[model samples]
Structure formats: structure tokens, C-alpha cells
Target chain A: MVEKDVIVNSDAGIHARPAMMIVREAMKYPCEVMLIKDSVEADAKSIMSVLGLAIISGSKLTIRAHGEGETELVDFLINLIEKDFRV
Target chain B: MRKLTVRYFIEGEGRIDLQLRLYAGEGGLDKEIKYGEINRPGLALAGFFDYFAYDRIQIFGQGETAFMNQLSYEQKMKTYSDFFSYDLLCCIFTHDYVPDKLFLEFAEKKNVPIFLSKRGTTRFITLFVHVIDEIFAEQVTLHATLVDVFGVGVLLTGKSGVGKSETALELIERGHRLVADDMVIVKKIDESLLMGAGSEILKHHIEIRGIGIVNVREIFGIRSVRNRKRIEMVILLEEWDSAKEYDRLGLDDKKYSILDIEVPYITVPVRPGRNIPVIIETAALNQRLKKIGINSARELDEKIKKWIMTEGQK
Candidate 1:
């Protein structure tokens, strides 16, 4: 298992657009990816789960992944949030 | 686990029929309720503080009220001063019995909330306990679909894009009710029953690979969807692996544990030409039969053993 915590610096937090981007990026990996906030785990591949977290600016999120290529998947998600979900 | 505060309880009073009116101590509305069981504080009021469960929501019925009414001003002051010394959750007076002026004064001074309910002592306790139990219930969010088939709640679980939604859609078309799709919030109620429901934003909506999000209630009418259901079985839909051996005889029972409760479980391999929905309906019916003491597999085995013995005797 691989896990990394990142702070969401986006001004708008994880609204619909940024939530979709996170889901889309997580879908590219075959392993299971999860986003956790306040001890509640949400499936990263599911758009509704990602949005349900209601993540806001400066919120701490933990990206956890298990199975093949788990470390790369976690790093990729952390990078996505750090980059303000540009792509 | 989620924390339950007095404010949440007050906000949810309408839904649970608590019929509570905040009488005093608005500042203490944020006090946490740690236990589900309520306390009467009758002994504590009489200057006996042994085994006093001050953390629980204290209930002041007629007996406690009468006792308080009989206390003299000096006695009331002494007793209440001792009572409010401990960190308490809140106090509720049933039967519309209002506390004395001194009691409310002490409550306000100590930042302890007091509420009044018109319901009788017994009725109010029943309702209060019911709500508190649910608030403290164990809960988890699962990435799956929940459907009610043949009066049985079946939880369909699997990885993403494993046809859980497709199978649930087909089940809905066949007259089954869809409780939730994609993200199912399951709560273990009363330490036995597992109730599954959807999140507020995602309830009654399903996401298909090509069709986007479809509102099941609007598309299939109200009868085709339910707000929540008790999860009695769990079925995991996985890709068909040639090397893996599946359960064929159905002799051994498989269980899936959620929140420490064991539920019947089955793994169904997904492949083309297999009617997964119909199979789920049958499994639900079979589970109902087993619940009624009619084990088809065991009964059949018993009959075969008796026949084989008769043949050997002949």
C-alpha cells in the first residue's frame, strides 16, 4: 500500500470540475485508489464519491493506493492536486 | 464514527418525533452525547451520586420532578450545585413537567442544556433511545449497488466497470427496487441489522458507462426505487477467471462481514450470455426459503442417502 497527504491549494476547492479531473486521473491506473478526508475514505475513481468528500481549499487529503503500480498512482494523484488540477 | 451533539439532536427532533423544546442553556447545545442509554438521575438528585451516569442524557420524569418540588430552597441549591458539578450532556423533562426556577438558574450558570417534552415519561424514553441508537450506529460507505429483490436486500459489490450498475438496472427492470447505486452508505443498526442507503446527493441516480447518470426514480417510477433497505446478502461480481474454481454444490456457506455482522455472501463470475439479474432473483428467493427452515440442498442430500440405504438393503 502507498499513501501520501497533499493540501488542496485550489481557490475553488474540489468542486464539480476539479472532482471530475481527480476521478479521470485516478481511472487511468489499474490499482485501487482512494481519497480520504477526515477519516472518511472515498473511492477515487467514482466521481460522486470524490465530490461527496466536499473538499475545500487548504483541506488535507490522503491519497491511498494498493495493488500493482500503487506508488506511481498515489504520486500521480498528489501531483494532480499540487498542480491545481491543471490537466 | 460520527459525533452526535445536542445541536444535531435538536435539529433532528422533527424527523424522529422527539417533540423537544429548548427551555434553557443554549450555550450547551454543542455538548456531546456519548452514550445511547438515558439516565433518570433520581438517586443523584437525592444526594446519592454513586454510579451516576452523568454523561448520558438525563431524563426528569414525574417522580424526579416531584422530588425536586418537595426540596426546600436551601436543599435545592445544595443538590443542584452538586449535580451541575459533573460534566453532563443535557437534561429533558417529560410529561411537560417544568423544572424549578433554581434548577434552570443552575443549568444556565453551568452551561447545561435543559429541554421539555410533552410526551409522557415512557413514550419519550422510547423515542429518545430509538434516535440515539441510530445516531451511534456503526456506518461505512461501500463502492457497490444495493437492490431489493423478493423482499431481500442484496448488495452487489465489485470493482469499477464490473457491470454492477448494469445488473442492478436489469433487476430494476424486472420489478426489483434499487436502494442505491455506486456509493452505498451502510449502517449497522442495533448491532445486527445492516441498513444500506445512498448519499443525499447521489440517491436514486445511477451511472452507466455510456448513458451518463440516470435518475432511477424518474425513469422507473417510485415503485422501482427505495430510499433504504436492509442488506441481507452480498454478491461480488468479478471477471471470469479460467484458473479459479467456483462454488458448485452450494453446501458450504460463505459470509461477508460488515461492521462485525456476518451476512450471506456469493461470488458470481461475469461473462457474456449469463443472466446475472435472474440469477440474483433466484438467489434471493432461495435465501428466503432457507430462512423458513427449508434447506433445499440439505433436504435433497438426506433423501438421496435414504434411497441409497434402501438399495443396499435390497
Candidate 2:
């Protein structure tokens, strides 16, 4: 498994639509992905789970993934979070 | 799960068939009932069709029937014609009220099915709405174990051998009820509510790692099993990793979506010496507290913030 810590920078933080985008991106890779905020962890591939974190701007998130292409998956997720979920 | 039509309604079992019989427009029995709600077309009969929900099953109760009875032959024809002009699934006359001749003529002419029921108007409407709700509810089957812990429907999900069944069994032994084991079939009965049940073959049967298939009802008694339950929360179990930091404060809320509806979600790490069942019980209780508008973590956070503010003032 691979893990990375990144700060949320989106102006509106991570809401429904942005969380859905993360789920969509996470589904592209054949890996089990999870998002950790403080002690709460959520399935990165689940839109509802991602939104459950109630992540706001400046919130620190730890992304973890296992299986094939986990490294690329984690990097892609970190980049997405760092980029503020730009189109 | 599937569309219900007038034909299915007439042939369906239960009290619906007790007094219900097709009166007119047999050709329209296959017409689908698009909406779950039934409508009483009181204003529509008076030439008001602005908000007429034509897709609903029209109910002709005492008031409607009395109004129809008071109408002249010409007025009745006009009203019935206008009412049946829209594409309606069917019309039901309760209290065994027979349809007027002109009403039947308009119904047959418009190809709208009409049914007669011996049940009173209110009772019939309630029963029909419930039956239609069941037939048209959205359903999805999930690979998980569902248990009612402290009156909360807790769905346990994870990999095949993540101890979902084992944890559910433990919960059952503690006097909780098991809704489903292995596969949970969830149905969205309302806008935001989901009801879950087990398949016929797997109902009340739970598979432990090495214990084979155990009948929860037999071992734990009837009170330990439920036919169906409304899913309120989801708990995902995963193997514990020392390097991964788990949520300790639980200030961050989480959710899991099933069938387009969001429900509370939590992930519990599995490891030796960890009392998973006890943790789950507390989770269920905590969920109940949240439902009642009491959030302990948020309350504590507010308290700490207040203390910090007072110390800074001093």
C-alpha cells in the first residue's frame, strides 16, 4: 500500500460534486483507495464516504491505496486534491 | 423494482382483490400506474385540470360519487369525458359504489380502467397506496450483513472474509436482531429511507469462518431475527495497519450512499485484542444519539474552545 498527505485547497472545500469527481477518478485504477481525515477514514471510491469527511479548505487529508497501480493512484489523488479539484 | 399496471393490481393477492373487480375498460388494464400517490379528482370534475395529476389512480369516494350523482345527464357526460380525457391508469369506486351508466360509457370510450371495491374510500386509498409503494420501490442487493443493534439498523460491509458475519453473530448473542446475513437486499421505500432484507435462501442464516452455515433464528430465538429493517448506518471493517492513522476524535463525519440515498458511515479497523462487537454496539448507540441531535464530539470541541477563550481573557 502507498500513502500520501495533502491539504485541501478548493475554495468551496470538498462537497458533493467534488467528492463525486474524486470517486470517479479513484474508480479508474484497480486499487482499494481510502481517504483519512484525523481518525476518520472513508472509501475514496464512494462519493458519500468522501463527503462524509466534511473536508474544508486547509484540512489535511491522508490518501492510502493498495493493489495494482496504487502508487500512480495515490499520486493522481494527491495532485487532484492539491490542484483544488480543477476541471 | 418494476412498474405496476392495472392488470397486476386486479390480479394481485391480499385485501385488494377481496372487493376489487374490473368494471369497465378491460383494454386499459395494462396501463401503468406511474405514481405511487392516489388522487381524488374533486376539482378536476369541476373543469379544473391545471394541476390534475392524470397519472395517478383516481379514487371515487362518497364525496365524488355524490357529486357525480347530483350532476345532470349532460353535465355527467361532460365531466366524465373531461376526467377520462387524460391518460389515467385507472379509477376506483370504493364502498361498492357502482359506476353510473354515463360514467362507464365515458370510461370505456376513453379506454380507462375502472374498478369497484367494497372497502371504504379512506381504507381503500391507504391500502392501494401501500401496495403500489411495495411494487414500485427501488431495490438493490448488497453483499453485507445487516443487524439491528439498539434499534439502529447497522450494515457491516468489507471484503468477503472481513468478519461481518462473525460480528453480526456476536451482536445477535447480545440480544440484537439480525436482518440479513451474507446478502442484504435493500429497497428504497420512500425518498430517503431504505429497507433491507435477506434473500429467501440466506435469510436468518449466517456463515462464520469455520462454523459453516448457522441459523441465527434457531440458535438465537425468534427475537434475534427480523424480516426487514430500515438501514440507518453503515460500518466498513478493514484490517488494521500500524502505519495508517485511524480517526481517533471522530469529529469528521462520514457517509455511505446506497441507491442514491446517503447514510451515516464509519470504518473500524480489525486487529487482535480489539473488541469489535463492543465497538459496534457503541457505534450504534452513538448513531442513535446523533439522530436525536446530540453530538458528543462537537459538544466537547465547543467546550474546549470556550475554555481556551476564558484562559486567554484571564
Candidate 3:
């Protein structure tokens, strides 16, 4: 698994909109991924639990990926978050 | 391959038998029955309160409808809607399910076999037409390769020179019946079942390196080449590779998804000395064992784990 930490910066604070975007990206990559926040692990591809976290700005979230194309998936997610999750 | 069939019961007058294969309906048994012919049968108008037995009947709509043509389409249809007293009726959705008055009446008379689908006109016709045929299809199971190993039907697959033909030849020699050779045309009658047929181009024929293409039926006779077989398992043969690490423990149950359905896949690495036919038979048996809730590989793994646990305790 490739793990990386990113701080939530979007105004929505990783709510439904951003969670759905992450789910869409995760599905495109053939890898098992989980998003961890404050010791709680939520399936990154699931929009419901991700929204449950209610991650506010500056909350550091660790994204871990495993399986085929896990490294590339980490790079892609990193790029997506670094760019402030534009889409 | 065993072809699955569906039968639909329809309500019509003089028991105007119309065979229709059932597709899903819109609501409950209370939906309108839309048939190709609008003309209502006499019994539909008279109501089944006096004398009726079977739930529905099957008719050949594509054939001559001598009785149906005698009365006006609207008049015959009225026999069901205006005259018949039943709330629901069986309907034969031949080719279409649009809102038509005559069709609705007949459906109201019979209480079962209501047809409903969101499919357009042409698709409904093609599907229903086949359904009718299936209900009346001649009952005959053709010859085919049938092996009861591991409880799953394992169909060997490979391109020419990939050794499907050679593997099958060896399998038959080992006392297994040949289902189909060269081309296995699979058909999805429903979920959970898939059947295969040999293509006409290479039916019962196997090509060996020196012997060229030879007809298994001609050489092995009728007792050898089977006409069809139910495919419960699939074994794909690929050219052997020293670099490719094959699954040895039988854990992980590698799955090869075909036509949206996942089947347990065992890729046999092909080489000159490898006895693929024997290996594939074992794989088919293993899959069957798994289906019946007995996983030998998992059981062995558990046994090993228990041994390790005992050693640690000591």
C-alpha cells in the first residue's frame, strides 16, 4: 500500500461533493484504497462514510492504496488533492 | 448444452392457444395483457365462471388465425373487457405492448401470465417470439461432452496450436465424453447456467501436429463425440512460461469473468510434457467440490495453520 497524508483545504471540508469525486477516481484505479482520519478508517471509494467523517479544513487524512496499480493510484490521488480537488 | 426454457400461459376464447415466453411484468398479476391480436375469444366474453380448468393456454399467433379473423378486432376484444367478468387475464405480448383497448379487455378475463416490459416494440417481438418457441420446443438433448468431475462442467479452451484439440483428444481417450470441439458457442439461458455448442466448421474435428484435422466422430464413432454439454467450469490453456508463476495452493480461486459472470479460472501452462487434459479434469473436480461447500485447498491450509499453532503451544 502507498500511504500519503493530505490536509483538507476545500470549503466543503471533504463532504459529499469531494467524497463523490474521490470515489469516482478510486473506481478508475484497480486498487484497494482506504482513507484514514484520526484513527478511523473509511473506504475511500465510499461517499457515505467519508461524508460522516466531516473532515474540516486542516484535518490531515492518510490515503492508503494496495493492489494492482497501487502506486499510480497514490500518485493520481495525491495530484488530485494537491490541486485542491478541482473536479 | 442443456437449453433452459420458459413457458407462459395466456387466456383466449375457445381456448385460443397462444404460446408466449414470459418476461417481467410492470406491476402485479393485475396488469393489462397486451397481445398481438386484439380479437377476444368467446370464453373471454362469456367468462370462465361456468366451465374452466387450466390457468392459461398457448397459441401460435404467427400461424393462420381462422377463428380470430371471423369477428371484428374491437368486437372480439370487447368480449373480454365488456363481457367477461374477471379483473385480470393472461396476455400474449407478441411484438408490442402499447396501450390498445382490444388487447386490455382479453387480459382482464384471465388472471395469470400478464406480460409487461419497458422494452420497445421490436425487442419485445424478438424476445417473446423466442419464448413461444421454447415452450413448444421439441424435447431432445443432443450429443455432447459430459464429465461429472468436481461437480462442475469444465470446458477446455484454447486457440488452434494452443492445444485445445489435443487436450480434448487425450481427455476422451481417458474415458471422458466429448461435448463439442473446435468452437464452443456458449448461450446464457438464464443466470447460473451456461451451455456450449461446437461450431459447424470444426464439429467433432481435432487437429494434431502430424495427423492434421481428423473427425472425432468418424474415428471414435457415435459413442465418443457428444452433441452438447452443460458448461459448469472452464479451463483456459496458455503457452507455458518459465517466468509465469502459477497458482499451486489453489487458494485465491482466480476468476475469469465472461459475459459479466465470474467463473473459477485455472490457467494451465502448456508445454510438451505437461499432461494438460488430466490437470484440467482435476481442476473441474476441484471447482465442483468448492460449489458443494468443501474447499480442499482451504482445508489443507487450515490444517497447516493448526499444526503451526500446536508447535507454537509446545
Best by TM-score: 1
Q: Could you say which candidate leads in DockQ? A: 1
**CA RMSD, predictions in order:** 2.1, 13.3, 17.8
Identify the superior model by TM-score, candidate 1 or candidate 3.
1
Query: Model 2: what is its DockQ?
Result: 0.02
Q: What lDDT score belongs to each candidate, Candidate 1 first?
A: 0.88, 0.83, 0.57
lDDT of 3 by residue, A1-87 (tens): 789988877665776566667877887876778777775555565443355455788889888998888888878777777677874
Candidate 2's docking class is incorrect
- At residue B275, candidate 1 shows an lDDT of 92
DockQ, computed on Cα atoms, for candidate 3:
0.01
What RMSD value applies to candidate 3?
17.8
Task: For candidate 2, state the interface root-mean-square deviation in angstroms to 1 decimal.
Answer: 12.2
In every candidate, what fraction of the native interface contacts is reproduced? 0.32, 0.00, 0.00
Per-prediction TM-score: 0.93, 0.67, 0.47
Angstrom error at residue B253, model 2: 1.9
TM-score of chain A of 1: 0.94
lDDT tens digits by residue: candidate 1, A1-53: 99899999999999878887788778888889999998778889887677777
Per-residue alpha-carbon lDDT of model 3 for B25-81, expressed as tens digits? 323343333432233234433443454322333221322123444557665665435
List the candidate 1 regions with Cα displacement exceeding 4 Å: B12-17
